[model samples]
Structures are given as structure tokens and as C-alpha cells.
Target: MSQPTSRPTTATRVYLARLKGTAVFDPLGDQVGRVHDVVVVMRLKGAPRAVGLVVEVTGKRRVFVPLTRVTSIDAGAVITTGRLNIRRFEQRPTETLVVGELLDRQVTFRDDSGTATVKDVAMEQQRNRDWHVTKLFVRRAARGGLMGRRGEGLVVDIEDVTGLAVNPAHQGATALLATLEDLKPADLADVLHDLPDTRRLEVAAGLPDDRLADVLEELGEDDRVSIVSGLDVERAADVLEAMEPDDAADLVSELPDAKAAELLERMEPEDAKDVRRLLAYEHLTAGGLMTTEPVILPPEATIATALAHARRQDVTPALAAMLFIVRPPLETPTGRLLGVIHLQRALREPPHELIGAILDKDVEHLLPDDDIGKVTRLLATYNLTALPVVDEDRRLLGAVSVDDVLDNLLPDDWRGADEEITDQAMTRTAHG
Candidate 1:
């Protein structure tokens, strides 16, 4: 992590209905729970400000996850920081539940137009990191319910609609930020990069930490540097912590030593510790390129748990292709590196079997100083998607995946080159 300027990014506008029951993932992308509702604090003047989400985790217990702790929110999943307050959620007098209380309520157009039932509400984040209710989706009552089409639905700005509470009001509309809800990080980064700096930073300020980190990674280095410099040091650190350790380490290396040191200290100990270790290694070395984050289990774990961990979508396919087995501590620098259970074999074994029983002990591990060439040859020879890196004592440091190797192998400007190739192909497609 390094002190940054600003995180230039696209604003994420999430509709309330789509978020309900969506999987809530942790910093590592493992599903922690499902979103049950969004909590907001109603205001006197502007749209209600969002506070956080009510997520239902283990034991059917609902807990509060604040917007500041949220890393990304999309239809597929809402990712948050690993830290959470597990205490049961209790609604206060000032708090509003968007999913529980607002949907289907009748609202009036502030201008005294007509009324429509609230179908959905959109919350948008701003440059200051605060979330505000920005839009509402409403439908006019169906004139022909059984025989004909239902009422028309339109996206409307929040100011045009009245009533956070259930009240009889008309729903006339105005278009807001409905189009930005579905953009991929790369596509969204392009859009943000083209915007004026002020607007770009404003949107970036509002994005979830992990999402902003992704968009920043897609931008050119100059733009990336400018944006990071714009963010406050604390927030800059948060974004970096949300990023993959290797990416974070690379970005941190680009900063002034003093700033980098300060920002790393500001990061969570677990996250900062990994990046610090990465910083000690050569950028192209196996230890530097490999992510410290990967599925690790102790010897006592079973195939059922291992398989479930492997099936998670958050971990990249390469990382998921093998599970590292260690001694006592499950975290990286994990106890003596025993072996890896390849996903292909794990799939065929009975779920009840112990993972230690099937562990493939023959795989040779790489030392931290191992060159990229060695990593490539080992992976190629074994036909492995990833290979473990270890200390002299055979303690697991991390695992290097195929993509990490290729990313470093490619030219530094490969992303720009890729775009050029794509544009040329599109031009040919048009003429052909």
C-alpha cells in the first residue's frame, strides 16, 4: 500500500431489489453470508443516506456490514472487508430498511404529478465516500392486470419522488444513473478515464475499495499514479489492501519510500504483513509474483471442506486448481509444506475422506529466489496451473499460478497493445 492521490473510478449504483439475498463475500471472495436488507438513515432535505447492509451469516444471525467496510456490490455478490461486527443487527428509530420497508410503497412526485408504487431504489456513492439514495424505480398501477401488460416502469431521481415512509404519492420520473450498475471494471475504468478529472475522482471516491483497485489496475500508469495521489492516505491504503497482494506490492513499490512505508503501516496487519514480505523480494521472482492469498488447509481437514473451498468463484481458477496442505497454521508461511491436492483428484475422491490421505507429495516446491524461468519449466513439466513456493525449511510461502507468470512475461504495455489489437480487429470486422 502507498499514499495515493485519488482513486479515479466509475460510480456504482446498486438497486435495492437486486441486492436482496445476494451472496456477501469476504475480502478473499469467500461467501460469508447473504444480504437480507440495506439500512439507511432518513434525512430532512436530500435522499436518505445509506448506512450499511444487514447480512445473514451463520446460525441465521443477521449482522450489520457498513458501507465503508464494503469492497464491492454487484448483482452476483457484495464483497466486504474481512472484519465485521457479528453482533445481531438492531434497527434504531432513525434507521430505514430499504428492502424490508420501502419496496411497493406508493410515492408522490414532488412536482405534484402522478403516483406509482416503488418497485426499486438505487443508491449511489459520491466522492466523499458517503452513499445517498439517488434513484427510484416505480411502476404505475396496471390498468389491465390479468388481460394486458403491467404498469410501465421508469428510473427516476430521488429528489423527484417524496416519502421514505409509506405515503400516498404519485410517481412521475426522471432518468438517473441506471446504466452504470452492470459495467465490468475494465469497461468502467475506460469510461472514468475519459471523464473530466473532477468527475472521475468523484466517482472513484464512491466506489468500493476492491472495485476501485481493479479499475486503477486497468488504467495507464500515469493515470493510475495521478488517481492514487488524489486519494487520502488512509483511503489509499484501504484500496491497496483490497487489491491482490502482488498488485498492491507493485503499486506500493512505485511510491516514495516514506509514503509507501506509512501506507503499509496503515493497512491491516494481516494484509500489510504479506505485502511487506513481497516487497523484500525481486518483482519478477516467484515469491514476488505469487499471491499470498490462496486456499490452505491443515492436515485434519476433510475432502468435503476442501471441495467446497475449491468450488468458490472468488478464488481464480488457477489458484483453485490446487489446495495447499500445511502443518499447524493455515495461513501463508504456513507450517511445513506437506503437499498439494490437485482439484482433478479431489473431484474423484469421496467427500468423507481426509485430504491428507490423498495429498500428492511428489511436487517439488520453488524457493523464494527461484527465477521465473524455473517457475515456468516446473509448471509446464507438471502440467500444473499453480506450483507452491516454500522456504528452505519447506514452509509454504505462497503459490505461483500460470497467469501471474504470463502477466510478468508479457511486455509492460501489454494492456495498451491488447486494446490496439482489439480496435484493429473491430475495424477489419466492419469492412469484412
Candidate 2:
């Protein structure tokens, strides 16, 4: 058959649902077959680009047809570049078939709302002149659905779909991770740890640096080591850089000396310095547990400024609960600690009031060499979530949060009980 004589002048957008089972024709106006599925190349961080279509040809055998050969899609018919190969379709590792793998899948939206069934996917032409799945059509059960009525339907941008709950029959880690894109790093880490080694590594390969760093922090030491070492040297260094200095140092400390040094050399000079500083302290001491990234501001800053800083998305709830006031040369390993202001005080104080005025000077602090026992005792005595650590000259080095202290004080298997603890907490909250 020759190429189709008529073709659409401009690219058109169409839903995947409408395209499936559509009749496909060659250039000579001959009926070839029907589209069995759309094939897309799954990417680690962006929309999956359309590679081609799977068409059910003679003898009901399916074959791959590259999108480059497609001329147009209109009125339930697809026009092709006129040539067709007669080989049976078999999906490669990098490819996902929309009809077979993605259709009818359950997905969680960006807002963490209840799951919705995927009804269709909106495809658009990209800058590269290739078609890509850019949005999703979802259906949610509504009030009327209880009586056999149709439910609400929505068209959402692809980015808004945070997670996919893959059918167990699909059984690909990449597909599972694609749907789990919306999970918190900690939650994702928990899931990753439970996966088999090869699958875990495959999923880890797709996570961005910041997300990987957060997951690494939540993972057990052995799992962290495994994931980090599995990544290429440059990527490993980037992931470490994205992590808190203390956490990065802890992970690096567990690695072989030669490998650790190589990764350190590959890291940014400033980030590597922070990690090296934490590595200088014994793991059981105050310095070892402290995070060098605590929220610290000069004494002259106002309560409003302090509050704004606390509200930043990057600041964890525990770290945002207090602000560290420091004197001149306000940098990491900052000059003498002036005072601290708890969030509670910041809220009640006038907006323009300087933090120095309401500083909590009687705060209990830690020396770098203080043992974990002493750190725990001080935190308990003061009822504080965090305690700053300083050197002999009173230069603020870092602050250890209660969670970190607990992690150290608890038995080695404490992490294994985390899910049970979380479940119990949820149960208690439900009852009350």
C-alpha cells in the first residue's frame, strides 16, 4: 500500500480512550488493521513519550508501528506513513503499552485526595514533534453512583497524578514507582526497602536527587549503603550533597574508606566540608547527631522574619518550632550563640519586635563531646525538641532534634517496629 493522500495540516490532541481500537489506514487508502495499544517510552522525570502503536494485523497478530509513520488521527481513524512491517508486537523493557498496562489503573491525584480510576489519557504533540501523554482523564464515585448513576469525571494534568497503584499482574517496578511518585519520601523509602534488591535498585534509579536523599535518610544503614553504592559515582555524590550533612556523613562513614574518600572528592567542596566536620565527631556524641542545617538567624531579625522562615516548605515541623539566634559572623559553625526563640513566643510577639528581645537565654545547650546519654537527659529535663551543640568558644556547630536522639537511644531494631508504632498511633487517633 502507498502513503495516505490526505493528512491533517496540524497536529491534533486526542484522548487515549478514543484512539484505542480505531481503524488504521495506509496511504493508498487501504484498511490495515485496528490499533491494539499505544506504546510509550517511560521516562524517569517527565511524561512518557509516544513511541508507536501496536496494531492487530492479519491472523489477529499484533505488530509495532512507529509514530513517525503516522500521518494523522481523525474521526476514529489513524492514517499511517504508508509502510507497515509484518512482525508480531512484543514490548521491550523500556516501553509501556497504554491499553494493556495503564488503562483502568487507579491513581492518586496531587492533592492526596482519594484514588480515582483512569478513564483516558490526553496526548499532545511536544516541541520535538512527538506525541506524549500529557494529561489523564479520571472518574471518581460521587453521590449519584450509589444508585447506578454515572459518577463525576475530571481531566487532570499529568503532573497532578501523584501515584499509580499498578495491578499486581503488571509486575514491573518501574510501573509501581511511577504510580508512587506522590508518596512522601519516608513512605516511599519504606516501600522501597520491602522490594527485592534488583527491583529496589531499578526504582531508585528513577528518583530525583532530593527525593533520593530524603529516602536515603529514612532507610536503614544497610539499605542506604546498598542503594548509594549501586548508583554511579557522580550520581552517588549528588545524592549525598542533597542530604543533610549529618545524615550524609553517617552514610559515608558506613562505606569502605576508599569508596568514601572517592565520593567525598566528587562532592561539592562546601557540602563535603560540612560532611567531613560531622564525621570528625564520634557517632555516639552530640556533634554526631546534630544537623548543620538548623534554622539560625542573626539576633537583629524580627519575629515576623523568624515566623516567615519557619513557614518555608523546606523546614521540617520540628526544626521550625524554634529559631537559633547567633552573634556576628553568622555562618555555619556560627559565632557565639546569642539566644533561642520558640515558635510559640514568636507568634504572640509584635511583628517588628526583634528576636533578641524575647530570647530564651536560659536554654540548655550541648558540647560536641557530650555523650548520647547526656543529650537525652538534657532534652528530657528541658522538654525541648532540639538542643544546640557548641564548641569551647561557644560557636554554634549544630542542633540535635529529639527524633535523632531517640533514633540513637533506641535499640538497633527500633526501626523495624516503626510501622507498628505508626499503626498504633493511627488506631488511637481514630478511637479518640
Candidate 3:
């Protein structure tokens, strides 16, 4: 089936249009507190644009800032120079949940079966998309009431749920917990990566290819390509387009030349061209590792203007940090590479200043000829999510993200580790 054309963008404005919620963050880069509220200045006409977030710094106080200021988003914390005066932020009725706040508290899921004790909660975000969740990651089963015993293993999916119970003192919020099987393709990819391959593909077939593409980037390279190769060309193309250009390139490069060509033919022309370019390089070089797509803008563009451009492009949350400020002749321009800035840094600063002012001095740069090992080492040491790859002319060709590196390095390893243990158990059971 042909995929729909709606490209999901990581605009806080879009998110605000749907459901508004607290943005949980371990703001210090150490997983801790959740964002209790986000305050945005909507356009007087309609369609609100997120101006800033009301972040509750863990164990400290609440603060707010424009969404444009977000820098680097990671599993641990959101890095930013945007500091808020504790007294200035508009306080909400709700208190932000901290690490110890919900300990031993009751948590509930949309899946009925009732409340369970919170073991620990995990936070996750879509790269380049700033939405966050405070998931009750693990639980001790509820017993004595509507929910049965503690050992039954909490059921994951139910069409709907009627009731929930949690301590008002702790104030943990309930979210619909989708089963590993029931999760959307992207979420399933994360769940599957944590499981075995037999289980991964078995579950993957239930999801649409587009969603599968989102998760594929998260899987080990070997497993990711194996699953894509198993798919028909059309489905493969849909998944590939759904991925970052760097990721799409890595996956496409793995296919037989003819098969890869056929899949590329079905993709959007620009996306197709990007994959082909990366394919031309040895899979380990800076050229091979970089993505052709970067959220680029003219160097003179104001932060407000950049925000508008980002909304139009549907740039994901992760890519927002690497927003490339290029001096345009659009095709290519002269000048050494300007420093890079985080999204948070961009937003919190005065809207009028040129982005060039805040660029990082320690920017990681790579020549197209640089080896893949050099690429990964830079990522490891600098703890960077992305690196810009430029030609000898210093013309930006693309960027390489950490996800792309892991996908290239690991190669289906995540699944096999889980698979082997599962297989051994199955064999023992069969023999017995």
C-alpha cells in the first residue's frame, strides 16, 4: 500500500494542538524531575506556537523558557543555558514528580487489570521531538482489590480502563501501557530491541512499515537490515524514507545493488539521492556516516525565523539541536564551518541576535575521507549525538547521529543476544 504523505514534525505547536501534558526531564542531565507544565504564546488568529516550557528542576524549583531554547535532548537530561529565576515561573496546581516522590506509590495503566505498585519509571523522547513521558516502567502487581495477585505478571493491553488509584501525595500520572505486541511500530521497535529477534519480527509484522522504520534505526544494524531485507521493496522504501538519511543510507547500502536500486526508485527523489550518495562511500567514512538532511537556515536568520522554518519542515526534536546555520547560495557557500548550538541555547537567548554568536567553539568537524572509527570515537569522547560532515570545500554534505553509528557498529547484535537465551530455553523445553 502507498504510504500517506503526512510527515510528522517535532513542533511543540503541533503537540499543543493535540494533548497538553507535563514535559518530564532530568534537566541536569541526570535523570530526575519531570516538566510539570509548558506555557506557550499562541497566535492570536489560531494554531498556538510553543514559546517556552515550564520545567520543574529536580529537587529545586520550577522555571520556564521558550521551546526554541532547547539544546541537546538525551535519555539522561536536556542540556541548555536557559536558566529561570525560581520565583518568576508561573507555578501550576500540580507538583513535578521527582525520583523519590513516587517510590512505592500506586500506578495505573489504561489496560484494566487495575493498579500496580511503582517499581521504577523510565523517561523517553523521540529524537528531534521534545515530547516526553514519565512511564511507570516497572511495577509490583496490584492485589486484594479488582487487580488479582502480585505474581500474575501485569497484563499490558485492554481496550479501555474504568478506574485508577494512586496516592494524591505522590501524584503519579497513569498512562495507557501498550503491550509489547500492541505498541505502535516505533514503540514496538524499542520494545523488540529489548527482546529477541524471533519475537521482534513476529511482532513487527503486526505494525505498519512506516512505524517500523522509526524503530529500525534503534535496532542493531544487522537485525535492522535483516528485517528490512525480509520485506518487499515497496514496504522497504516506506520504512527507509521514514528513517533519518544517515540511517536510510546505512540500511540501503546493506542490500544487494539491484535490490537497493529498486527500493530507492520507490522513495522520494531527495531521500533516494541521499541514500545513493552515502552508498557511494565506504560505510565507515565521514561521508558514509553523514545524513544529507539537516535543519539548515541562513546564518543571518533570527531565532524566531528559524522557529517558523522548523515548524514548516516538521523537523524532529533530536535534529533541532544540530540546526545548521549556512551562508546560502543555497547550493553551497564559502566560509569555514560556523560553530553549532543546542536548540535550548538557541531559544533562551535574545530572539534578535544572529545564531552565529552562540555557536560552539569545540565543534566536531570531519573531512569526508575520515574513517568510521574516527567518527565513532568523536561521538564517544564528545558524547555528541551528531557530527557535521563537510567536503574539502567545507561545504556541508550531511550529518552523522549517534543512532546511525550504533546501527552501523552493532549489526543485529541486540536481537541475537536475546534470541540465544530464548532459543536455549525453547530447546530445553522441547527436549524435556
RMSD of 1: 12.3
Give the Å shift of residue 79 in candidate 1: 13
Answer with 1 or 3, whichever has the higher lDDT: 1
Better of 2 and 3 by TM-score: 2
User: Candidates' TM-scores?
Assistant: 0.63, 0.60, 0.50
Tens-digit per-residue lDDT, 92-134, candidate 2: 5556778787878878767755567777766787654567788
Backbone clash tally (model 1) = 17
Best candidate (score: lDDT): 2
Show model 2 residue runs off by greater than 4 Å: 1-173, 418-432
TM-score of 3: 0.50
Ordered by lDDT, highest first, the candidates read: 2, 1, 3
Q: By TM-score, how accurate is candidate 1?
A: 0.63
Segments in model 1 whose C-alpha atoms lie over 4 Å from true places? 1-180, 190-199, 418-432
